[model samples]
Target: MASHIVQNPSAGCIVKFMQGNEPQIAWVMEEQKGKLRLFLPNRRETTLSPSRILPWAGPSYPATQSKDAVVELLNRHRERRERLASEVAPMELWEMAQGEMERAPAEWFAELGYTSPDADAVAACGRALLQCKTHFRFQPPEFEIYDAATVESRRQAEEAARVREAMVCGGADWFRRLWEARIGRHPAPDASTAPEEPVRGRLEKMLRARMRDPETVEDEALWKQVTKGLPDDPHLALLLAMTWGLVPEHYNFWLDRADYESGTAWEEPLESETQELIRAVEEGGSLPPAEDTVFISIDSATTRDIDDAFCIASAADGGWDVEVALACPAWFWNFDSALGKAVFHRATSIYLPEGNCHMMPEALGEGAFSLFEGQARPALVVGAHVAPDGTLGEGSFRFSTIKVAKNLNYPDCEAALDGVENAASPFVESLRLAAAMSDRRLASRVEHGAVIIERPEIDFELEGEGADITVKLRPYPAAPRAQLLVAELMVVANAVLAEWAVKNDVPLLFRTQDVAVPREYAGVWKSAPDIARVVRILVAASLDVVPRPHAGMGLSAYSPVTSPLRRFTDLVNEAQLLSVLTRGSVRWSREELSDMLMHLSIRLEAAGQVQRFRPRYWKYLYIQQQARAHGDECCWKAEVAEENDMWVSVSLPEVQLGLRGKRSLFGEKVFPGQELHVRLGKVNPLRNEAVILDVREC
Candidate 1:
């Protein structure tokens, strides 16, 4: 997390805090630690120690200025939300919501002018009530509160010091990872080829070898050539794995490839997590120690800062297997730890064009806790013995330390179709089969649809010095075991949570992106027929939930379970499941659950934007550098890959970019089918926006 914020451009001239914007404060009427505090934008450089705040800022000032201004903003917001919320119930149900917002520091409420805050409050409650106990609140303090001693210059000086000291990138190990991120070819270079291969004929020959066999070949020449080709960065492969699922963990397992390529692969501690796993295996015992509690597990995207394992079993009924997995973050860090929350906020792993930043540390991500191959690492398996048709068969959910026997990737699992050594074992094969069954279960729900988008990715060659990377699909992009295997397991587990909630009448987050209706989602799918079709298609995929099709994935009720590293929804999904299934937590009232869902849905959307736009801005920068010769107004031809009422996926192979539309560009209305010039214009440095202009006028 970058601690030093550049400036507060959005800062209003109200009150101040220690020479900065104490623009926002979080005050739950009950507990402070339970929730987070966002002080204007984000408290990036500020070491915000939450002080018990009593109504200090005084009554509302309206987040903006004029009564008319407040009325305009609040009224407009209310109108939009009321239309959406009308489907649920009468507006009278959310009385508690008004109270919660009122308690949010008088200044915060006042910022919105409180002209008719009750209405805004109602809308907020309705949205939250609808989604995953989630919703976004507009909190603008009427007047800023400040201690007012320090100057901006002094604050800047202090912030610089904090950033320099806090950033571990100041160290060599971290620096090396960042360096390779700029210019490294992902998957390690050594893993790309053998120990020796002529540089000239390398690309063509390796392409051929890959076609012959994607698995590791004991070729020394290829091994050496890989080291020569790849940059020494541990985080590069980690980054690729998180974003595109292109680089598999097979490329850098154990320490051989990691040490060879990252320059410190062999530097495992004798008393480290690796040693503990080996020791446990030697002793014929569970991973680490039965009583140690914290397990250090690692994957390509995650490092050794995890303390639990999870797997699946069948449910009690003669149906699909129920999934049971252990999450030890509760034992490792608290909600208040700045670092911990940052990781939690990320919700899932994000693979960057160059490197990856994991949600947790390396020790926890890949340690004694991780269910290692041929070793029974301690795990909290949520197993479901699902039937071939995705019905919940007999299942069990428990914590245990069991040997995983065979660790396999997608290709390996696929190869198991043929007789191959180390093919996906029966245990994995069952999970895959179970996932397929769950898909059928999901498919049975006719109202929702799942939108599957193949957003191509990139591998940058950044080694300290930034090299421009052309983002594209992996040359031979194929499905892998880990991808869908985890997906099905999570869906089933999420279903379990939903089932438990309903059985107990626990109110919980039920997520749904607003459908493409005429008034709502008008940004896309303008035509009534097109909008209705999109909604029908999406609603069909959003299964097992009350809402109809997602109108996106084509799944009536499609939810993501794979990456908890980058998405908050995944974290909430786990939390809900654990609370309901494991601890037998009480369900919130439907109203409460609805509120939570609104926030979760909104945050998930926000987090996705943050994850997407940040690196994408950087990628766009590199793209311009890569295709600088194409000039600005060439015929950047594109074929309509996918489209809805709101936007269309337009692919232009020339500059290698996809243009997303504010509204749908479906059917014959787009390029590739016709000649259209796309002007790759200016980019906003802060928003990270790459503006695309249609230049038929050219």
Candidate 2:
């Protein structure tokens, strides 16, 4: 037994004390009142009370031990601690399972020199290892661990189970659950009313089989399988189809209403007779060539289907003799044939950011019928004499063949016309004559109620594919002089042909726009919004057998006789003109023409939607990509074009994006013509959505 003596310890006095049931040796450093400062053999110092210290009994080393002897004692203790640590290092149950141990018990831990207090404590550790066996594989009964191969096998089994469960419950049922959750309604409790197991199973199987190979929802067998015995709900069918990957997220449902193909492929290959005719045209026939005329075509650099080219020479009667050569595809085209019917179905070429879907076959549009330079192609040549004041004399129209002198893009023509010195440019005189013609035409149109909107055109070109895709936006240079020249020439050619058609009593399709405008509202409006308002007030232009005034162009009559490569209406008109010149009769009567236009109108409306919406889709995608690349802090300078009580319509002229913003962001001061700085957010290309986040005065 140890005697407990409560006495104050002096400085440098060695003492023994109990530290958590283990005895420790400490030397007293100082004593003050009720506290003693003690330094342990491990060099840790602490303040304690007198009651905590015990009198020393075994050795008086604190007074007689040399510094070397004390250090040697510490070194021996450290060696013992390190040996113990090596023997009892905490083993991860997983590491233990990887070794020779098949089954471990509490005694096994003791045999391995584990440092737990008792058998029960070791057993508690074994229980913890058992719980870890789910992620780690362990033998049962006394659970010890297993190797990596066993763990991987368990993981694969779990994944297979999960996949099976998902197959049974995922496709349509998952979509149905989401729909129910979104609408805040639970499924009906009647199991009998629910879709039968076999039917649901079949649907799921079909969906899973096509998981990697998706097809359009229009596939008859797939559609039948998806909708069999399901409720007659279009929304539910659409949701299931979308969820199962049968349709794209941004798919246009309106596209399904029409039967015409929208890709680059034709509905059917050209008939053998049509092919022969095309070959014949390409083989070069004997035809009268125009005399001493220089025909130059002004178009885009990428223009391939060259339709019309022009020449301007001084007439003997104090006027400019204009010769407009229209590419005569109608000479080979059979209006009553199947190829003609196919063209009528398409109605017009669809232009998108990706490219164009040509109305005529490429073999004709870009080959034989295309007015390539140095190729003497058949043409409907229209001759007119323009006076110095730009008044047209009597015009003459006939069929002839002419070689195009030059094919000049807008830039080249504009540069040459601006007197920017190019070597031997042949179209300068013609360009000058074109400018005079445009001035005269503009003055005449302004005298009427023609409104021209000169909005900058934004051209979108997509490069690469997938994650590497980049959208390049360039402003299509509006070369006013060059554009006006082409516009005036096309209009004059159409006017000349329309006059001849009327005088010859030929029943041709005429573009008529008869709107009841205010008698006082007769002036040329150039601004976009102003022109848009005028367009809204006017009736939509339409095709008719009867000749009528085109109020928008301020013409007594108008018809699109150019660009037969692109527009089916122009091709139809060309065929009519050709028949009148050759056979002295029209190809189609007024009734037959009206019947064709009715069908063409429906198809045209659908094609128009594709043309209008697809570009807008890509434009929205561009904005989305821009927002993601530049982040939220980027602000675009926008002008308010129109405003209402709740929204302000703003136009981003740089990107040609017109979007609306909340009126509250800009306060009541935001009105039309107000320029503002705006930030975009929540741009979703798949949904074709964008939102203006904030707006402030510039």
For each candidate in turn, the TM-score is 0.44, 0.65
Model 1, runs deviating above 4 Å: 1-348, 374-378, 385-396, 418-442, 445-464, 467-476, 480-482, 507-510, 514-606, 629-637, 641-649, 653-657, 660-698
| Tens digits of lDDT, candidate 2, 218-277 | 344544433444554434544454543445444443344445465545635655655775
For each candidate, how many residue pairs have backbone atoms clashing (under 3 Å)? 167, 1
Candidate number with greatest lDDT: 2
lDDT of each: 0.39, 0.66
Residue 496 in model 1: shift from native, Å?
2.1
Cα TM-score of candidate 2: 0.65
361-444 in candidate 1: lDDT tens per residue? 434345433455554454444555566455543334444455544344555555553445454545454544445554665454
By TM-score, how accurate is candidate 1? 0.44
